[model samples]
Target: MRRLFPVTDQTSADRAATAPPSPGPDGDREWTFDELAEAYAYPPLAAGAVWLRGNMVATLDGAAQHGGRSQAISSAADMRIFGVLRALADVVVVGAETVRREGYRPARARAAFAQRRAAAGQAPAPAIAVLTASLDLDFSAPLFTSPLVPTLVLTGAAAPSERVRAASKAGAEVVIAGEGPGADPARAVSALAERGHRRLLTEGGPRLLGQFVAGGVLDELCLTVAPLLTAGHAQRIADGPELPVPARFEPVSLLTEGGFLFCRYARADAPWISRDQG
Candidate 1:
């Protein structure tokens, strides 16, 4: 923690003591920094099993990215929200493709959250997860070398055991997300829930997010609508295949910051189509 940036409000012991358990919202929730944490443990106000919430910056025209990355849409306040969101996560799950494209590293600077976790008797680090259909990952990256917390690789049974072992050797936790040949998003959440991770924050690159919503596993959907407009080739988040699940879930809260629109949603019920679109 010596090389880390200190919290700005650390002078008062009382304030530091009550620094708030913030649930990751990327700064969209109406709750204060501390109120976000309350959202985490808050019992399901509805029917979704897991929160499949997403955080992203979209242009005014609804483009999720401008130049393959959504960086251009983020503002200073949104960045602060991003930090709080990361701190709220127990594990930050991402795809291998995203892991490589994002210059990814798992741990973030949230000394307050780390201290709170210590008080709760849990490790200060959130388990970084990489989801791969075939386990094609770069084992040489520092994301795998960080010993403070090991990355978890969630894969299917068909995922080669040899590759899983290699990932473990690279200092990652290779956990089979499901027992079958394919990855089941539902089973993956169940696996995490079994491990006591009742709250899951899933950051997306579009396809994965669509799958979560398509599979009926998303409990909450959090989106931070960026004010900028980048009418570019970058993927639009909701442009993927339509989800028959949860036809409609009402918004619990809405926030605006740095010209971005933050909307919170709760899943209503299972609304998957009666017939699979096979």
Candidate 2:
């Protein structure tokens, strides 16, 4: 990895003189752990609703899956960024289908982010908030029972009473965000922000990402472009009805490691316009 993005002696001295000193191995050459952390750090939260961001991985050919899951198209560098995003978030929002298909679990505290999280006044670990309309999640799963914070079930007010009751009885906080079929992404974001969760990250399973896109509430997206090409039939990262008009996003940052590209894009109208705006 060091050789992939090497820094010569002169370049190292130049960077050291210009950039603030960052702590990590091979800080002069490749992207060290600390370098990556600094590169992907989220901006400070404002007094209003939370800033929602989505994280996802896709193949070189735009396939979001290969063997019925995204794991087949992921890499170590991708996972490293994944953990960093979770560490920086105050809560993780996921779709229930993703939880069921991926066998989701609670977000455990990472040793690397202990000091960073504490310094930012964040909880020991971010909470997992699942979006479900049928309320079909497994309440007895460790995700609900063993999280540092109780799992939150975001569902529509019209969800089945029995399922909601079961979720609550199993130690999950059932939050009703909408009255229709599924939880409205806008309402869900507001509900989370109301609870003082200002830094939000959503690991979408495509369909839920579509809802967030449709809702116009997604502030930014950190997409990992995997190196492999999956020719198999698979959905795109965001799957839903076509947009009325193309949504624009301002590219914020782009980083690469071993052919995998990590790209962050913010909504066109978002306050944090760009890195230059920051």
> Which candidate number maximizes lDDT?
2
In model 1, state the lDDT of residue 251: 54
Residue-level lDDT of model 2, residues 44-160, one tens digit each, is 444565788899999989998888898888888788888888998899999998999999999999888899889888898999999999988788899988888889999998899
Tell me how candidate 2 scores on lDDT: 0.81
Candidate 1, overall lDDT?
A: 0.62
Question: Could you report the Cα RMSD, in angstroms, for every candidate shown?
Answer: 9.8, 4.4
What candidate 1 gets wrong by more than 4 Å, as runs, is 1-32, 35-50, 119-121, 179-182, 238-240, 269-278
Clashing pairs in 2: none
Q: Estimate each model's TM-score.
A: 0.76, 0.87
lDDT of each: 0.62, 0.81
